[model samples]
Structure formats: C-alpha cells, structure tokens
Target: MRPTKGKLLGILAATFVGQMALQVGVIQDYWKKNYWSGQGFAESLSPDQTLLQLFGFREFLAGILWVRADSFFDEGNYDAVLPIIRLCTILDPKQIDIYATGMWHIAYNFTDEEQRSDRRYIPSALALGKEGSRQNPNTYELFFETGWIWYHKIDDDYHQSIKWFRQAQERVDMLPARRNLLANAYQRNNQVKEGLEHYWKLYAETAEQYEKQKDIYQLFQQKETLEQNLDTMIVRMVQRGWLAQERGEAGQRVYDTTEPFDVGFSARVIVDEPKVLRVQGTWNVLPVGTRIRIIVRDADNPNFTLAAMDWDGQNEVVLDPERDATFMQDQGFVKNRRFNKRIDMSKDPTMYPFARKSENYLVEFYYNPRSASLHVQDKFGWNGEGMTDKNFLRTDVRKEFEWIPGPKAGMFTEDWKLAERPTPPARIVYTALTLSRDQILRKGDWIDKTPMVQTSNFDASRFSVTTEDIIDVPTLRSSAPSPIAPGEVKKTGDNP
Candidate 1:
C-alpha cells in the first residue's frame, strides 16, 4: 500500500518535524530537571573559593552549567560563578532570559556580611547584559539592561550611552516606553545629537509625551551644575554641624557608613594671643564673666569657640546639656542627649571652670547616638591612639579634648563621673585667634567680610578677635563682619 507522491512527501515531512520536536523537548526537560542541582556549580568554581565543599561535586558534574552560575552567585561565590556563567553563555548565547536573570543575580548583589560578600558581581552582570544586547540586537530589554548596568553598576561614561541608544533604534518595531527610555539614556550621557533627535522624535512620532521638549530644554539649563554645588555645600555644612540631613540635599553626600569618625564638629579655642587676657597689669579691666564671641578664620565655622580662663583643667564643671544625664533636681542634673543651641552659663557648680593655659586642649564633638536621634559625643579617644579617659571609650566612638598647651605639652583628663557634668561658662571669652588677617591675606579681603584680623599691642602672639574683626575670605561669597578696633574689646557689661 504505497502512498501517492504528494502523500508520501507530506508523511516524510511530518515525521521529521515530530522527531526534531521530541528531541528538543527531551533536551529541555533534562536541562530543567538537572540544571540547578547546586553541585555542578561547585565544580565550576574558581580556585579561590571553596563552594564545592558546600554545594557537592557529583551533582555539579551532571547539572547544566548555567544553573551552577546562578546558585554560586546567590551564595556569594563571586569568583566561582564567573567562570560558570561565562561557559554557559558561550554554550547557549541565545538564551535571552538566562543571560538577563543569571548575570543580574551575580553582578548586582551588594553584601558585605563577612567581608566575603561578593560586591564585585556588578561587572559580571554588565558583561552578560552587553553580550545579550549584542546577540539579541533587536530586543529592547537586552539593550535596556545594558544601559542600566553601564549607567549605574559600572562607571557611567557619557559615551557608553550611545550603544544603548543604537540598540533601541533598531528597525524591529520598538515599544514606545523603551523608545523613551533610550532617549533618556542619551540625555543622561549628554549625547547631544542622538538625544535631541530622539527627544523630538518622541515629541512628534507618537502620542506618548510631546511637551517633554521642555525637559530636554531644561536639562541643558546649568541646573545640573547648580544642583551639584548645592549637594556639595549641604554635605560640607552637615559635616560642619550647620546642615543636618541624610542625603546632603539630594546627591552631594556620598555616604560611606564604613568611614571612620572624623572630628566634623568641634569647638576649638585657639590660643592666638596667650598673653592678651593677662595683659600687662590690666587684670581687673575684663571681669570674670565677660562673654567674647570667638572665631577661627583658618577653620571652617562656628562650631569652635575661644574662651579664656585660668590655666587649670579644673574650669567650672557645668551641666553638659548635651551629654551629662541628671537623675534629680539640684540632686541630679538632666543629661542632654543633644543640644544644637548654645546654652547660657549660670552659678551651677558645673558652670564654666577655668581651663588651664600654657597647656592646650581640643574638645571633640560627635553626633551619632546609641538610641537617640540627636547626640553630641566626644570623638577623641575613638582610635585607641591617645585617650583622655581610656576606660570611658567604646571601641567605635569616643570623645576627647585635643589642644597643645605648648610645643609638646598635652593635657591629661581623668574619667571623672561627677553627679553633674559641668556646663559651659555663661561668658564668651576670646583667649586667642586661629589666624590673623596677615596670615589669611597680605592684601586682599578674606572669605569672611567681618573685621580684618590684625596683631594687637597686647603684644601677645594670638589676637583677641572682636566678633567684628572676624571677616570672611573674599574669594568665597560671604558677608564681612564689621570690624572691632584693637583697643575696644566688647565687655560683658556692654550690651551685646
């Protein structure tokens, strides 16, 4: 019963198709069942890691290599997964979903749980994304992933944006959303020609969003520079205690949680003129409670104050409204978890005490708290280097008093837990200046517009800077404080 010519041809064609379909289905099923056994990935691990011991080598040998890469990557076997992923991609470059998902899992995982966390996966994801985009050139998702990896995971090179733009521009009908995304990448990387071209195309071609021309127009508006500077200044102020925000006004604050604590906020009393207060026989002229505004022209801001007292570490121990805790009224002082505002001094035993001269001290201030949001901690004894109170410090954060009483003279403080920590003196005393006008500028104006600094007949080394004398550096846009003459030091008796 031989079939006719047409029937025979059709029968043969059907048989061939059926056999090929069955073989492909069987191969896919086998791959699905054995691929992610976790052991095969162990074998493919690089020599550096020991994942094989954790996942098994028997299962690894029989598994599809691609699945091994994904599991190893998830397990933080960065070095191990790279080779496997590479091999898998080489074998099946056309597997679009695998290329996207597997590479992403390995490349973008950012964890440092044991210092063994694989933060280096971003590059692997980027490499796979790029390969996928090349293989599936018409696929918008591949190019989108590539652009994302390049824009975020890798160095955001402006030129790299062009590649993604080209991929999205393929003649194989692209989705409007993906089309717009390509335009955005172009703008981000500053691809002027392609960026503007697509932007306008988006405006004219479809009903997606045409008024977006304003976005393109505004993007070029020096707003980026302005925004960038705004970011930097916010960070700078936050570090200086002036600004308090998490992200520094958007992007300027590049937070490194691992960064060691620096003395961003401190009150440095510079002994510019050590001899000025004890001026030749003018002892009674300035009374005990005189408040003098302070300055450190060489330093950054108002966090530091210069107060003069007898050269003894035993200045009045006042209530530390910022740190000291109070259990009762006169019996117990309330401990302030945080105090941004400067408090006035009173007759409290913890009030201003005479800080010893001839020997200097630097007072370190920190902000992070164990429980509270606002805290002022001392950061001096943190590194375990030079400690004022060795036992009072935690391994991480500690505060210390830093100042050179002399060339090599350092003050040592005992970790005394008095009932109440002494509060700052009620008066502002100008013991000395940090930098003189001559030191800042021989001729031009300073960053501060206040009183120009000058050496005084107090004939002392450091000058007593009247609030007016402290001026800004002309270079930076700051107001100059009105000048106070050398002879007319503001008296506490005078209305401030």
Candidate 2:
C-alpha cells in the first residue's frame, strides 16, 4: 500500500475538495430556508458568482435607484421616479424605507402638486405600498406606510386606515410614532375607547423602556411628564363621558363602536338667542317611523314647554320661532300642515318676540321608539341687562351643546370622575406599579409614594347599569336671573 508521492498528493486534494463541497451545500440550504424564504432567487446566477448571487448587491442596486429617485423627486418628476422605485422594489423588496419613501412621494408629494384633488395618486401609492408589504410580509414599516397613506392621502377614511394600522400594531417592532398615529386615527373616528386603550398601552410601553435606561434624574423627570400627560388624557376622556364607570363594572366602558345605532342620538345648539333656541343634529339608525320630539323650554321654568313638535325619523327637523306659522294656524296650536320649513332666523320683530328678551333657554330633543328611547337636553343663558333694547341683544349665540347618549345604548356617565379621584381603582394602580418597577431588581420600592394615578383599566364588558345612570348634565347654567319687563314676559311665553 506504499503509494507514490504524486498519487498521495492527488488523494489528499480530492478529500479536501469533498469536505469543502459539503460545507458549501449546508450553507446554501441555510440561506434558502432563512434569508430567501418567500423571496425569489435568480436561478440563472452561478453559485461561484458571489456578487450576483448574494442579497447585499441587490440592496446596493436598490440604494442606487433610491438616490436616482430622490433626484427625480427633487425635479418634481413624481411619475418618472415611480418606475425607478418600482424597479428598486423588484431588486430588493425587503427595503422598508424604499416603500415608505415611494408611497409618500406618490401619495403626499405628487398629490400636493395637484392640490389634493387628483384621486388617482392615492390609489397608486396604496398599490405600491401593498405590493411592497406583500413581498415583505414580516416587516411592520411597510404596513404602517400603507396605513399612513390611507389615513392622510386617501379620502380621510379612518376605518380603512385603522385596518392597516392594526396590522402594523400586531408586529412587535411597532414604533412609538406608529402607535401615536393609530391612537390619533381612532380618536378622530370617534372610537374613543379603543383610542384610550392604545394610549394607555403606549404609556406603559414608554415607561417600561425608560426604566431600562441607566440615567436616573432624566428618567424621573420624563416619568413625571409622561404620567401627567396620561392623567390629563384620562380626565378629559372621563369628563366628556367617552369613558364611564358603572357600579358593578370591572372597568370603565369605552365608546369604541361606530355603528349608527351606537351614535343614534347627537344634537348641537345651532342658534341660542333670546328669540329662538335652534338645535340641529342627527338621530341615525333608528327604526323606521320612530317618533322624535323637539322641545324648547325656558331654563328658569322647566315646567313650561316653549315649543314642542313630533317628527318621524324619515327627515331632519328644524324648529325656528319664525317658521312655526307654516306648521301652525294660531300661535301654539299646530294645524294639519305639512310644510317643509328651513331654519332661518331673519330679523322679523312681529314673529320672534322671545328673541328680543335676554334670558336663558333650554332645548330638549327626545327620541322614543317603541323599543328604545333617548333624550338630549341643552341649556343656554344670555345676560341682557346691560343692553338697552332687544335689538341690541347679540344674536350670535353659538354655544356648544353637550349631547349625552342614553344608558340603554352602552354609553358612560359622570361616575368615572368619582371613581378616579382621591384614589384610582386597582387597574390604574396596577399600571403605576408595573411601570415603577426597576428593570434591574424588578422591584417597586417607590410605588407607595408615587403620585396618585388618574387612569384605570376595568373590564368594560362587566359594566351593568340601570336607567338611573342617565343623568341630565346641563350644558350651560346661569347663577343670576335676568329681570324681564312686563311686556317682554308675554312675548317670550306667547306662541310664535
């Protein structure tokens, strides 16, 4: 078995080549499974051609195209840059910034060039973003970009925006900016509960991140500021009845649903003057032929109904002192008339004598279907003592009215204020405790001395309240009474 030197050398070379081949095969398999999963590889490229075979060069090509696209963007050649960006995506679909920039250019920059009127650009950007997300399904940034385009560029459709943003939110790599955007979208769309939930989530996440940092003084200051902001948001939401607490509830209820049935009762005081108190809003999603009553009353004398009329849910109702004759024969008696009257408060001295007096008034809107009922009452007051004549009384009384939804519809009430003051509930305390824990020791030694938390998280589904929760929270109440002249009293009470 004594071989020659050349034969032995050949044998050794063959064994080394075989080992190298095996190692190469193992590496290729790993790359295929991990790096190139769900991605197309150029089959024609040779294994030995490292530059063409690797993913890095594709990224480099994309970068080059990105620079070129930027130049085209600077030149205001939006359409021209799109094709270049498209090619870049093909070269490296996983590049998140490429998709974000391309979508932004089409959605915002290009649309701005056309004064936001061209609807074509929005869909184009959305399509590009979706394609990018399709190629890189694991990335959150691409999904966030799609949501941003839908929210800001498209027709302000928060529903569609939230759909994509939620997808981004599900990813663990979600940024604070993305979370803030999602919260803003929810709030804008009147999904207050969901918005508050996300805000609290953000607050917790931020606190957790801050605790991990080494700086002590900066952390304390930041923590204080963040806690204050969260408290303010909680108070505002509770005061507005966006989040309400019930006696048996585990947590406050979030008015998160957007169904018209959920928003069935809404009203605004369009005009509040001495002569007339006009209220206008919608009673959406009520059953067909539902009876809605519009009632105006003197705030001083709640018993006296200034004006009352019944309306079917088919059309909008407008109650004006000047236009009542169209529906009435005498002052208070409503004749069998079907006049479609519009709301206009023109100066007609003979028609609206109540408009001349400077006093407080109450407008109530009552919705009572056989199955469901709702009431929204508003109070508006005026100080007319200083004004010499009724003509001098200001007619521009555009006070905002507080529209409270009924308890049967799952709306919250003023009870949240009481639940939060002096001591916040267990849920809020839990949040503070969790956030205050030190990252190193995982201990909350300073928890007891922590500032009283203003917000809490309760199980909204556990809320069970009776009709008693439906309290009449007045919009405006005057402490002083205005002295009325003898002649003015008759005019204010008399029918139009």
**In terms of TM-score, which candidate is strongest?**
2
lDDT of 1 by residue, 375-425 (tens): 111111111111122112232321222111234321121122212113211
Report lDDT (CA) for all predictions.
0.35, 0.42
What ranges in model 1 sit over 4 Å off?
1-80, 114-125, 171-173, 191-196, 208-496
How would you encode candidate 2's per-residue C-alpha lDDT over 197-304 as one tens digit per residue? 876777787678777974756555655655675676576554434344323332444332211122223333333222222333332221222233343333343223
Off-target runs (Cα >4 Å) in candidate 2 are 1-57, 112-114, 137-139, 170-173, 209-228, 244-496
The global Cα lDDT (0 to 1) of model 2 is 0.42
